[model samples]
Target chain A: MTGWVAVAGLGPGDAALITPEVTAALADATDVVGYIPYVARVAPRPGLRLHASDNRVEIDRARHALALAAAGGRVVVVSSGDPGVFAMASALFEALEGVPAPHDLDIRILPGITAMLAAAARAGAPLGHDFCAINLSDNLKPWVLIETRLRAAVRADFAMAFYNPRSASRPEGFARVLDLLRADCGPDRLITFARAVTTPEERIITLPLSEARPDMADMRTVVLVGNSATRRVGRWVYTPRSA
Target chain B: MTGWVAVAGLGPGDAALITPEVTAALADATDVVGYIPYVARVAPRPGLRLHASDNRVEIDRARHALALAAAGGRVVVVSSGDPGVFAMASALFEALEGVPAPHDLDIRILPGITAMLAAAARAGAPLGHDFCAINLSDNLKPWVLIETRLRAAVRADFAMAFYNPRSASRPEGFARVLDLLRADCGPDRLITFARAVTTPEERIITLPLSEARPDMADMRTVVLVGNSATRRVGRWVYTPRSA
Candidate 1:
């Protein structure tokens, strides 16, 4: 069999949001690899082998997928939301950099509905205007860089979407982010916290920056801070196209 | 029939990239309205009426969709990518702001795989780091704001995806943008021009900022400028997870 590896995004949480392209990739795969939760989203079959690992082992998972594919197995590496956005696609490429032998393997990155866009759609179009997406976790980068990007985004008057805002290991980062936003964006700037978006436990809260607390977000949540012009239109919150 | 309006994204010219949620919405739609090219993507059924209009009439299209839905016709406003991202969702809300009667109408924005992400996936993960999306068309906003955002994005070391980079009416804007990028990002920074992405006519070209020309991008293209750390791995271009 001609082997290949497809880094597929499953979208946010809803199965309906999964694209037919990703679905086809899964169907054609003989082995699937990803974080435990994401791998569980795939169905079990007679010939397919599922290799699920814990979080923070992304590089190892990518290496494993490459090995399987190099051995002539069709491998699908799954990620929640778009694989290109803070997900598995980059990690897979990073793995490729560490080893030269697998450079010739067939690899494809399939895009999906990322968390920010899904949250933006659910809450109306707060990101309708120009926007910036920042990952708040300081695990890969320093806190100073995050602050700089946040400040620069505010200066540009671009709406902001924050990923990996809060986690049990790093609870203080999101609070500092909130503090910075309240100080820079002032009290009335709109902020949205969408938890487990598109899932059964989905909860969306939109309030002013002054009213936002760090506890409003968790690892499963994606936060959105609007530009200076974003506001509520009746029950919906949107940034004007002109702004 | 219970009428509603669903602003749907058709997912960058590929039928398989469209989500089941949008497909279900279109199947239930009695009338579909959008720009001529986007509306033409939807198949016509006996009961379904397709309303294709020329471009630059987003507000009028929004108003028409609202009128249809308010008159108890299920309507879907189609956009090429996610409706909330420089597309029809915000325009729909802007139309809602003009008239109060349609405030009670049922409306939903269905997310799709946007062109940038599709292009990024096709060229590997050049948007893996913190990124900003800007619409280079100065139709709604002034040219000064675009320049400000571009400078700020570069200062913050964020990769950028530019939409509507160049059009027939405004051919000189992209040349200016290329000049600005080369000045700020230096000659060695990588830039990718992906035109008609995910389509049969798709073409992707990657070069240094010094080598990018104004003619490389058109209205059908989405341009990606890498962060300082973005580079080529084998034949693929990707931004590393850690900058």
Candidate 2:
């Protein structure tokens, strides 16, 4: 069999949300590689090898997949949400940069439903207008850069979705974010915290920016902040299609 | 039977890209309403009704779906990509604003693989970092607003994905966009034009901002402009996760 690499997205924690394209990639893989939880999502098969690794080791995992594929293994790297969105696809390409003969390999990136969109769907159409998706984690980039993007998004009057809002290691960042949002957007703007979206533990809450707390968001949560014109129609919150 | 309305996304343009959750909604729907081409994608069945309308009639289409669902008909309003992203979900809520008793009806927004994400996967992960999604069409908003968002996005150094980039009625808007991008992003910045993504007629081209022309994109294209760190490895283009 010809060896190749397929970077596939498992979507945001729902089997029904996984696209047929990604499902096919997983089924055809000789080896599956990813973070431990993502690798656990794939079922054990007769001929498939699963390589589960820890977090913050994206480059290492990516290099392992590339090396395996180069040695004639059909490899699939799994990412929880869309792989291209702050996930393994970019890391795979970054690893490919050091490959001796990268041009000879075949690779494909399969898209899936991302967490922000899934959270938006559950909380009505808060992102129906122009939007910005920012990763709030400061592990890879500076916190000042995050502040810059947040202020720019607010100035642009765009709806915003934040990924990796808070983690156990960094609980203070989200508090700072809430403070910034309350100061800039005022108290009336709508904000939704959707945790473990589409899963059994799913919980979604919409409140004013002033009432939002830092503890509402964790690593599994996606936070959506509406634009100036967003409002509630009956029980659902949505941004108008028009400005 | 109880009535309901589901604003569902058909994805960019592939059967495999449509999630099973959306498929289940369509299977249960008694009526399907959407723009001409999207409605045509659904197969006619014995008990199903398809309502195909023309462009620029979003509010009317939304009201019709709402009325049908209110009267005990299961309705599915379809959109090309994710329904909540410049699509039918927001329009449905806007129409619900004028309903006599909107809370009595059941409504759900089913997400899908959006065009930008699909296109990003196709051309590697050019949107792997922070990004802004802007609708270039000035039909609902003013040109000045679009320009402001463009400038803010540039200042933030966020990658950008543009929807509805150009149309026959307003080709000059995209020309202005190209000029603005050329000035702000400089000559070496990368831009990818992905037209008819995931479809048989799909065409993708990546080039420097200096070489990009307005004619390269149309209504069917989703234009992606990479951040300063975006680069090519072999034949693939990707934006690194770190800023």
Candidate 3:
């Protein structure tokens, strides 16, 4: 058995977005591991073993995947969005530091369409120019750092796209970020709120930042705050390069 | 017959990446219009009228597409990557302003993969945090505004991706922008030069801002400059949010 490990991005929710290369990698794997929801998106094939768990077990799941590959099993670890973007790719590497004796295990990462890209696509070209993506969740980091980054992005006049903006436990974090942004970027900035993009429940609304209320967003929504260059022409929203 | 238009994004290059919904829309269209290269990418179908032109005639082509749709025909205007990002969607709307029509024309934009996302995926996730995209092309816009935006992005410590960095006529512009970035971002910043991402002749290299030579990139290359938080770990590059 070949000791090999591959990290695959499942793209947004739609299975059609899965590339042929990703499909081939999964088909050749003897073991598959990921968050429970992501693993269900792939088609089940013969001679495949799956290990699913809740979201908090990232390190544990990575260790299990590494051990399986070290034991001479072909394994593939899955991440919902692009693996390298705040996803399983880093966790897998961090976990590898603790393991010893396996110097020849082949490891590779395959990319996929991230939620930001999918959301940007659905809401016109708010990302056409310079932009930023921030995660409002302060579970691992302090609120101070998040606030600093938000201020910097706003000062730079970058169209901003946010990920993990709000969660059930800390819903007020997004509101605070908005208040700070409103102060720096002003009220007329173009804003786009997208939820469950590329899925059946996909919802997208384009409005001005002044008109955006805190209740308009949730954990699943990705909020895009346009720079001063962004403008609305009829039903569409875009940020054109200044002449 | 009802007049309608669909603006479709033809993902990076491979036909497989085209969403099923986009394919259905294209199949049902009576006329297709785009720049010559983009129109050639789609497979040939019977009874479909093709309207192709060079890059300089975008306004004329857009006006022609609108006229076709207004004559009670289903029209699809194609663009490489996402239609709304520096493509035909906005131009189409700009051309529609003066047309006198009795019926409401339905215009829909279907999103596809953007070049920055493809480049970010090819390189590691240098875009994991706050970032910006700046166009180095001065053909349509003044260079003064571009410089202003670049300086702001650098001072803000936002990772930046530059589009149309060089051309045959203006090979020195990219180097000039790099010099300005060096002043604000410092010489130690990490930069990635991605050429033809997700294509057959793809090339990706990571280097430091001080050592970045203009000869290393061309018009086809998309330059990604990492913020202060970005780091290089062996073959991978990443930006970690402050904890």
- Go through the candidates in order and give the clash count of each: 0, 0, 1
Q: Which run of 10 residues does model 2 chain A get worst, by summed lDDT?
A: A234-243
A best-first ranking of the candidates according to their DockQ comes to 2, 1, 3
Candidate 1 ranges beyond 4 A from true positions: A101-103, B101-103
Ranking by lDDT: 2, 1, 3
Clashing pairs in 2: none
Question: Each candidate's fnat, in order?
Answer: 0.91, 0.93, 0.31
Tell me chain A's TM-score in each of the predictions: 0.98, 0.98, 0.94
Q: What stretches of model 3 exceed 4 Å from their correct place? A: A72-74, A93-107, A241-243, B96-103, B241-243
Candidate 2 vs candidate 3, TM-score winner = 2
lDDT at residue B10 of model 1 (Cα atoms): 97
Compare candidates 1 and 2 on DockQ and give the better one: 2
**Which pairs of residues collide in candidate 1?**
none
lDDT of 3: 0.76
Q: Write the per-residue lDDT of candidate 3 for residues A1-243, one digit (tens) a residue.
A: 667888888877777666565777888889899999888886787899988889878889989998899889888899876776667776666666666643455777666667776676666567656666777778767788778778777666667888888888888988898788778888887789988877898988998778888878887788887778777655667666342
For candidate 3, write residues B110-180 as lDDT tens digits: 76666666676666667656566777888777787677778767666677788789988998898898788
Clashing pairs in 3: A130-B133
Q: Which candidate, 1 or 2, has the higher lDDT?
A: 2
Enumerate the candidates' DockQ scores in order: 0.85, 0.91, 0.34
